[model samples]
Target: MTYVLTFLPWIVYAVLPSAHWQWAALAGLVVAVGVIVRQRAAGYRPDALIIECGSAVFFAALAALAFADPDSSLHPYSGALSSGVLALIAGVSLAIRRPFTLGIAKQSTPPQIWDHPVFVRTNTVVTALWTLAFAVTAAVLAVLAHAGQGHSTAATLVQIAGFVAPMLFTKRYVAAVQARSVPQ
Candidate 1:
């Protein structure tokens, strides 16, 4: 799903070894930029690339920092910072009344139903779940980083679960809403 693809850079960053954090940051920047270019070339509107754009900005800055000072103190807490940034982005999207999921969903959903109450509600709820997930993941990762276990298996598992749980919720929630709207 396009929604999942938006997180590919984050996934890349998470899986790579922290000993080579600069490389990981560079890789994330490259992947984020590539995803944005690919989606744009495929005719996706800017609105549909909210996460992609945010990712590009985040990764570019991170890469610059990592390269400029490879031994920066921020390196150890990059995971928590990443999740915190994501939470900020998602939270701001909701605050502005434009859940990022709405744009991604529009790619598959018919335009006729784009303005439907159920459709809007679905995106809102899904985005809220994602925001909560990111926030919680940030908190957990912060604790781990403080304990000097930022790159521990527990942190990695938490990151994976954070994305997976919200993804599953989005899929099932959308399906259930669609089913409810169907005529008996």
Candidate 2:
């Protein structure tokens, strides 16, 4: 559930009316910064705040563009851009051999298992799933934006599913792995 909080800013940005994108972007930036500050106060390290950091950078730039030119041509493709940036962040985390999920998972998991192959493998797979979902969502959103349906019901559903599907997968995958590790 805590992991979902990382996406709160994006959700805020998405649900806002397109005409209010400048505000939405600014809101996202504020929320992202807030989440990071809260987490830091709670003793979370930079590794655990990877997504939050990325969100802050993305939203900062987005907010600047949104306010500087409220009528910017890129506004319509904001959803795709957001998802693509997420994909890049997640992909970079994997490339560095530090799955973004790994840091979060460690919060709930025992320290003894942090270095276990199973734990690491599970995080890797889960991170890969998120990367794939974000990539697909970005592509579909790009196409929809091009077709003038970027803010349509279908686009909203796609965005929701993009986050939800990976979340559900993470829960089930972790449970299954735990179940398999238990002695008969």
TM-score for each model: 0.97, 0.98
Candidate 2 per-residue lDDT over residues 1-184, each given as its tens digit: 7776789889999998988999999999999999999988987778888899999999999999999999998988999999999999999999999999998888777899999999999999999999999999999999999999988999999999999999999999999999999999
lDDT of 1 by residue, 32-140 (tens): 9999999999888887888888999999999999999999999879999999999999999999999999989988888999899989999999999999999999999
Clashes of 2: 0
lDDT of candidate 2 at residue 53, scale 0 to 100: 94
Candidate 1 vs. true structure, TM-score: 0.97
Off by over 4 Å in 1: none
Top candidate by lDDT: 2
Judge candidate 1 against the unseen true structure and give its global Cα lDDT, from 0 to 1: 0.92
Candidate 1 C-alpha error for residue 76, in Å: 1.4
